[model samples]
Target: MRNHGLVAFVITTAVLVPAAAHYLSAGHDQVVKFATATTSTLELAGAKIEARLEHPLVDPGESLRIKLVASSAVGKRLDVGLLVYGSKGDEDDRVPSPPVGVAHKTVSIAIDAEGNGSIEIAIPLAGAVENRYSPSPFTSYEVLVMAPRAATKLDRLRRNSALIGEGEGIPEYNASASKFMNLYSWRHDLQGEDATLFGEGVVARLDAHTRTINPAIAIETPSTTEVGKVFAVAVTVKNASRKPARGLVLDVETPIGVVDGAEGIEALVMPDNATFDLDAGESRRFQFRVMPDQVGVLGLYARVTCNGDDCDDDSALTKSGTFDATEIVKAQVVDEAPSIVGRK
Candidate 1:
């Protein structure tokens, strides 16, 4: 949970552990990546803003569309500037630099007097994919969005040149009179006490996973139920690829209330290291027994992973080909159960 004022980067790469009550609000190339859809919200200066994706997964050649919505307490049209940069790097490695493809994009956002406005941008990810020779080339097309000190230098940037469209190589300046749009340096500059005075920008990231094949995950649960009553959650995983996949695992998570531990929350059904093999077109189903303690909406998250392998003969030097699929379902917990909740 890294936050620079109001930036949210929810990395959906699932950890192969027995998670209790982990909630999820829910990508790719040959060595293409895919990412689950997500949303981030934060406050910039006195403005409330959010960035979100409508689709759950995206791949190469597809357009990554993001919707930016913002509202402020101010009583006038507010103008702000933002930067979009993309790069290719290892999924595990940090330090993203050398902006890929068309350098980056600079745009201006205007919030009306009502302080409500939205902007949508679609970027083609063809240039963001990295071709690798490694047996299991784990690479990520990292797309970063930075909105710096909204409305400060937007007029100047627009006056210099049309900063809304794409650009070529990394240019030092947008126009002859325009200063540089260095998001990396601008972020450090805003870390001072005067950051709030000039307003702050948000940084959002999207990643792609490289794999030979992947699995499809699905979960089924009731819509409404009563507190302290048991309900069953069924999870299905299918290998839709033509090749066989090993190291297959599935995990289900429920809410572990404010209490100390997992005393009477949900029963432990699936083991942590419960790995199996699924041949081509094979599918498996698992059921989890759940009981809600308090009354409210309970979020159920399930993730399935396949080591969709490309490794050595003995599989000693394993090529890490990990494709994680996740799904989220919500069950309403009321004082009384519906007719459907009485079954099983």
Candidate 2:
């Protein structure tokens, strides 16, 4: 079956990472110095609240630190609670598996008689072993800060998935946060202490580094080809991990009505579903010759995965987790059978 999700991801990445070559060419030091952290601010009941990540990217098996600061016009101690949840970088927090993974921490800022204070908290990140399964190389987290009373309610809602059934929290918090953010609107839904304690809150995002290995895939094809003539297409898979990638299955999908029937061309080509092994830092290139009978555009899609069902458990090859690579190639098919110039 064709994976439209993979196709969409491939298309979007191609358009978004046009400058990736330049970015990757930089030195390690230059890459490490790149700034990637963000900060957010909100206002509630004459108090200015700010939230930011102390370090946006945490190594695996470490903790993510976030710093929160608030300046209140009212000279009294303010209690604000922060609820944080995480998911794979590509996945949305609305549906977090094993719902208990959510992190909840409450911190109080002592607003002095002058009303100015800030505090920071460290949230422990889950490792592959801790999660009891292999995880993606990157994980993203969302942080929501609200008054202790409102935060407690939201935390319960988030943990139990009560507000929006099971495995969904985005919509519930989105609605609640929107209502609680506005001074005039907070009273409509929230009661006395809850409404009064609730102040302006801020939302923030943080990304954690879980792994270092990153495999890559590339597809090449001519822009135009003859309808009846066999044309060349190439697919390359590279393993960037320190260990070899075993049980690697590469699946290529062609437009309807076209077959891998290379009449006379001679080159190594991958079948519809080809399984192969790639060593560390090595790349494998597979070629294909396609002949189209109609004159129009043809699209070729390719997807590769490691440690899938096709791979056995010999224990020789590293079965760390599943790695995927997807790409699309389009070529215009032209009919070259007409001899109009000579006939005329």
Per-residue lDDT tens digits for candidate 2, residues 1-344, read: 23232212111111212312221111222211122455777664477878887455454456667787788647666666776655533223443342234577677777877778888888776632212243332344556666555567655544443234434434343443333224323334555655455532433333333322223655555555554455555656677767676777665454221112312111112234556788778777665444544444344445565665544443322222221111212345577896657655
For model 2, what is the error of residue 228's alpha carbon versus the real structure, in angstroms, after optimal superposition? 44
Instruction: Name the candidate that leads on TM-score.
Output: 2
RMSD of each: 13.3, 14.8
Candidate whose lDDT is highest: 2
Whole-model lDDT, model 2: 0.48
**Pairing residues by index, what is the TM-score of model 1?**
0.40
Write candidate 1's Cα lDDT for 153-188 as tens digits: 432343354332234443333451233234333455
Instruction: Say what the RMSD of model 1 is.
Output: 13.3
Candidate 1 Cα deviation (angstroms), residue 286: 1.8
All models: lDDT? 0.44, 0.48
